[model samples]
Target: MDQQIIMKIDDLRMYFNTNGGVFGNKRKIVHAVDDVSLSIMEGETIGIVGESGCGKTTFGRAILRLYKPTGGSIEFMGQNITDMPERKLRQLRSKMVYVFQDPYESLDPRKTVGSTVGEPLIINHLVRNKKEYEKRIAELFEIVNLDPSMANRYPHEFSGGQRQRVAIARSLASDPKLIVFDEAVSALDVSLQARIVNLLADIKERLKITYIFISHDLSVVKHISDRIAVFYLGRVVELSEADELYKNPLHPYTKALLTAVPIPDPFLEDKRDVIFMDGEIPSPINPPKGCPFHPRCPFATDICRTDAPQLVDMGHQHLVACYASQEGRLPK
Candidate 1:
């Protein structure tokens, strides 16, 4: 069976212009998301993972048109929405939603949780009357494992996890085809994180909704993502199936990231050699001439320092953008 493409992004670039000089006279561009192209299929969750300032969140926001992209194109559900007017984009928003990391900030303090959840329904005119709105609000709460009666409570009344659940319920209230979860579980406690991750997986299965799960924690992403894309600075360094990425990481940076994730077994953890890359991530404002990751990559060569390598499929649909990998110089 051929899968339907939900979103198609080509050479997506998002740049932010800011004042640089001490006098605030010089214009400096922050390449938040640079030349990123990705295709998302319906009913599949694609994970975007990278360290802080790697443009993972920006990429997600760009795809949803939350930010007016400086360059490139974004096609959603077979329609080009990259330059769609705000008035028209508002109509399309019902099919796409964003779940922010901090529920406390996303939810209103004065309104009841029910009101917050049903805002989408009101905007989209999904309900005919107050009775339908109330009933749908209850159903949304129940879907996220929150009691329908709790809808009357305020955001301050709910715990962190519960508040996040409320936020999730609100996102689903619109019956969106795509949801962007930006560090949704990173702020929760370990146990809470596990429960929310499981809940997200369950929701995806039952609803058959596509997700863009953005996080720095590879372990959590592994559980929910069908495929993973590793970002560095403002570009994707590697992309592959979840299992293949964990088992055989082609890029040097990908290998380093996997090594950082601790194994559950103490004995095995002690025996494993962790690959520690030198130096911090480069500044996106003035990224390295060649690869964005070359500054910290241990396997960097002269070509890696002079020329950027584009993403290439080595095998099994694993795409990597490292000169070392392309030249077969990556150590086994």
Candidate 2:
């Protein structure tokens, strides 16, 4: 189903300037997205999975220009958008929108649902008359399975699931081609998370939209992703199809992540090795030189300590950065 590249982020870098001293004197950088590169197809969902603080959210934000990138190029539909002027970027805002993690904090409590959803249309001046605006808002609400009549109500009146639905409706108001779901359902109840994930999938087909889904939940990524990229610290350690990644995770960090995902079976639970990783995540201000994951990896060796492994393809769309074999028989 690949027609053309919809979004391409090349060597994206975003570092936050953090003060680390008395009276906020010493300013250090937190290397969030470190020279990351990826291409997103027009309508495929690309899931980004990583531990918190590993830069998944930062990467997503960098893509949408929420955070101005320090370096690298972002191309949308083959147009270089890295340095697109703010006015131009603002004009193109409807094409790419971000659905934030905390629905409660993300949505303005003071604004009514109708006004919030219709804000985009008003800003873009997409409506000719008042009737058209109300009709569009009603349609968006209906699409997300929200009560169209509740447009007059505030966000606090709804549950977590419904709040997210309202946010989704707002994001869809402008008919965006790509939407960045930054832990979009993480704060919802377990039962509601599935509904949102499934709704995202269903709406993608219906609307012909592309998604860059950032989540720590591997299982949710497994559900919605066409391709999955596993991030360790600030670098991509493994990337592959959904099933291939889960079945044969090459990176030690990826393997550890998968092992930690609780399987819903009492019998098979004890059979698997839950890699309880030791040590806190190294400070992003001064990450290790070699592989960022090498310090905590059980398979770390001299080579891993000194020379970082590149992302080498192990065939069939699977790529990994680990040089050692788990079973100790194969060559690096």
Candidate 3:
């Protein structure tokens, strides 16, 4: 049997217009996500890692059709949805859901947990009557390991971890095929984050749900992802299997990111090679020419300064966009 491709992104771009431009118009574009392409397989988690402004969240929103793409296409289950009509998109969204970073903010204080979880089922007509809706809500709560009796409680009544579980329950209420976890565990404590991550893994194994786990923390992403995509300034600089990328990072940006993740053992941590990235992230608007990371890359050459590199396969399911790596010139 062949692995199912859940989502395909082709040259997707999400640009925001900044204030002031040539004709006194807000034509200065901030390249939030630019010419990025990747595919997601069913039943696997894909981690997107980068600094805060690298556009991972924007990419997720664009994939979910929450933000209209300025260019390129997004295909979900082999169907093109980049320009799909709103009515059709709404109907299709039942299988595509998002679990936001802050559960407290995602859930409305005015609504009870039961109502919040049942809202999607009711709107999509998944349940025939109120009793059935309530039953489904209870099931959702149970699925996330929450007590069904607590369905009547409001958002304020639950702890942070419990609130996140409620958000996950709400997302799963409609039996989604894919879930975008936009830093879903970032706001929780370390212990709570671990539990939630385990819960997510359990949910994936039981329900076979695909996930796009976005976060800046390498450690967190490493723990949950099957494959990882490293983003820089609005573009994906590298992508590879989680272990392969962590063990052998090809792109300069990726190398820097991995270096920053501290090792657990004190001796290993002290002896580990660390690369300090100089200068801050470049502005998306009026970004540097050629490779976006050339300005800060230690191994940047003339080619890197003059031309951007495409994501090229480097064997073993690894892909990188860097002149040095492609030329086998990357330092050992």
Global lDDT of each candidate: 0.93, 0.88, 0.92
Clashing pairs in 3: none
Model 2: residue 224 alpha-carbon error in angstroms: 1.0
**Using Cα atoms with residue i matched to residue i, what is each candidate's TM-score against the true structure?**
0.98, 0.95, 0.97
Better of 1 and 3 by TM-score: 1
With candidate 1 superimposed using the best TM-score fit, by how many Å does residue 242's alpha carbon deviate from the native? 0.2
* The candidate that achieves the highest TM-score relative to the unseen native structure: 1
Better of 1 and 2 by TM-score: 1
Stretches of candidate 3 exceeding 4 Å from the true structure: 21-26
lDDT of 3 by residue, 75-157 (tens): 99889999999999998899999999998899999999889988999889999987888889989999899999999889999
Give per-residue CA lDDT, model 1, range 1-332, as digits (tens).
Answer: 12899999999999998877787678988999999989998999999999999999999899999999999999999899999999999999999999998887989999999999999999999999999999999999989999999999999999999999999999999999999999999989999999999999999889989999999999999999999999999899999999999999999999999999989999999987677899888888898998888888888888888988999999998999998998889886
Indicate the worst ten consecutive residues by lDDT in candidate 3. 19-28
Judged by TM-score relative to the true structure, which candidate is superior, 2 or 3? 3
lDDT digits (tens) for residues 132-170 of candidate 2 = 999999999999998899999998998889999999999
Tell how far residue 186 is off in model 3, in angstroms: 0.4
